[model samples]
Target: MAILWKIDPAHSEIQFKVKHLMITTVTGYFRTFNLEVETETEDFHTAKRIEFTADIDSIDTNNDQRDTHLKSADFFDSANHDQLRFVGGKYESHGDEAKLHGDLTIRGITKPITLDVEFMGTVVDPYGQYKAGFTVKGKIKRKEFNLTWDAVTEAGSVVVSDDVRLMAEVQLIKQG
Candidate 1:
């Protein structure tokens, strides 16, 4: 029988990091997101489906001005595109690690992405719930998603890097 799993938001995080000024890195996270998974066993290696969505307006970088600019038409354009989504297409395992192939949609642009996944094991929580953990990492070029906003410093360094690294720690609870 197939089992359904729902992401436990309180125990999950979706974050990204990008180079700034070609020297430092700026990190940010989406405060609201969800993931759904379907599997035939408690072992996530058998997962059959996975889908994720994040609210673009929930982006938080701890800087109000930067956040505002990111939401503008130059970046994510949250006013017009409210959400980003990912649909998993395949799961390829190699020993203890796996690759999740998926289509990610951002700012109305869709592109294929492959995420490196590490299964962190499963356990029964204190609340008597079966929970599984996973760490996912990936990278993407923001410009490919129509986030073309950019600037250059007086030193000729780009203000924001086109490459963004995605990182997530997801905890899923099996639904009854």
Candidate 2:
């Protein structure tokens, strides 16, 4: 039987960064997201399945206008695609670090992506619950996913860079 692990939303976050105007980077986050992992044992290396999803409408950049634009057809197209999903595939580990390969789907497009993960180990919380933590980072090009909306400043600088950086601080609760 496979063991199930569920993300502890209260202690987890998914964020992304993109260079704006080729000068400053703007940070954004998916306020609503969920991840689940299935493993044969307590060892994450034995994980058989991993799935994640983030609600497109819950995106936040701290700027209402930018957030709205991101949800529009130009970016995430949240109106038609309510969520972005990732289904984990190959998992390669080296000591406490690992590479997680998965297919990420956004705006109806799916692409293979690899994320570097640093296992933060597991612990039994005061409430007697078993938990694990990880820090994940990755990069992806927006245009590849059809997020091609672009604008050029008078100086010929792109409004939003094509490259996007992904980061996640995740905590999971092991279920009995």
Candidate 3:
């Protein structure tokens, strides 16, 4: 039988960094979201599957006003694009590391992406449950998703860069 698990919010983080003001970069993340994964691993031949989804409206950079502005029509437009989803992807392990591929959808745009993943191994938690952890990181241009909001600086440079870096550390609990 295969095993399934859900992401523990208290153990996961989703964040992004974008160049701002033509000199520095700003980072932010969502305070709430969930993901579920399934696996049939009893041996090397059996690989795991993962599905990730997120809520755009929950974004926070520690400022409520800025968060509200991000939800407006200029950025996420959360009312029209409430959810961002990733179709579960598979990775073949190579010496303790893996490369995961999937389609990431955001703001009505979907693009194929590849994430360099590392299996951080699993353990039996103090709570008496088995858990697995993974780290996934990748970069995608916001313009590809039509999220091209930006500003011009007096020095002839753009206020915000086009490339956005996505980084996440996720923990999946083992299901019986």
Candidate 4:
């Protein structure tokens, strides 16, 4: 039988950073998301499956106008494709350092991506619940997923950079 683990939403966060006008980077978070993992044992290296999804409508960047635009057709088009998803594949690990390869789907396009993961160790909580933590980081090009909205200033600076950095601080609770 496989062991099941689910993200503790209250203690997890998914964020992305992107450059604006080649100047400053803007950070955004998906306020609502879910992640589940199945393993043969408590060891995450033994994971058999991993799945994650985030609600695009929950995107927050601290600016209402920009947030609204991000949900529009020009960006995530939350009206159509309401979620961002990731299905995990090969998991390579060496001690606390690891690499998770997976297929990431955005705007209906799926692409292979690899994320660097740091296993933050497992512990028994005060409530006696088994918990695990991980820090994950990766990068993706917006245009690759058809998020190709473009704009330029008179001075010739692009509105948004193609590269987007992804980072997640995740905590999972082991289930019986």
Task: Give the Cα-based TM-score of candidate 4 against the true structure.
Answer: 0.99
- Model 3 misplacement above 4 A: 42-48
Error of 2 at 117 (Å): 0.6
lDDT of each: 0.94, 0.98, 0.81, 0.97
- Model 3: lowest-lDDT 10 consecutive positions: 41-50
lDDT of 4: 0.97
Q: Give Cα distance to truth, residue 74, candidate 3, Å.
A: 1.0
For each candidate, give its TM-score against the true structure: 0.97, 0.99, 0.92, 0.99
Write the residue-wise lDDT of candidate 3 on 8-111 in tens digits: 78989999888877588789998778887766763322556667878988898888887897788778889999978887566767866787778889898998
Candidate 4 per-residue lDDT, tens place, 77-135, comes to 99999999999999999999999999999999999999999999999999999999999
The residue pairs in collision within model 4 are: none
Query: Candidate 2 lDDT, tens digit per residue, 1-176?
Result: 89999999999999999999989999999999999999999999999999999999999999999999999999999989999999999999999999999999999999999999999999999999999999999999999999999999998999999999999999999998
Clashing residue pair totals per candidate (backbone < 3 A) = 0, 0, 0, 0
Whose TM-score is higher: candidate 1's or candidate 4's? 4
**Candidate 1, position 83, lDDT:** 96
Looking at candidate 4, the ten consecutive residues that score lowest on lDDT are 39-48
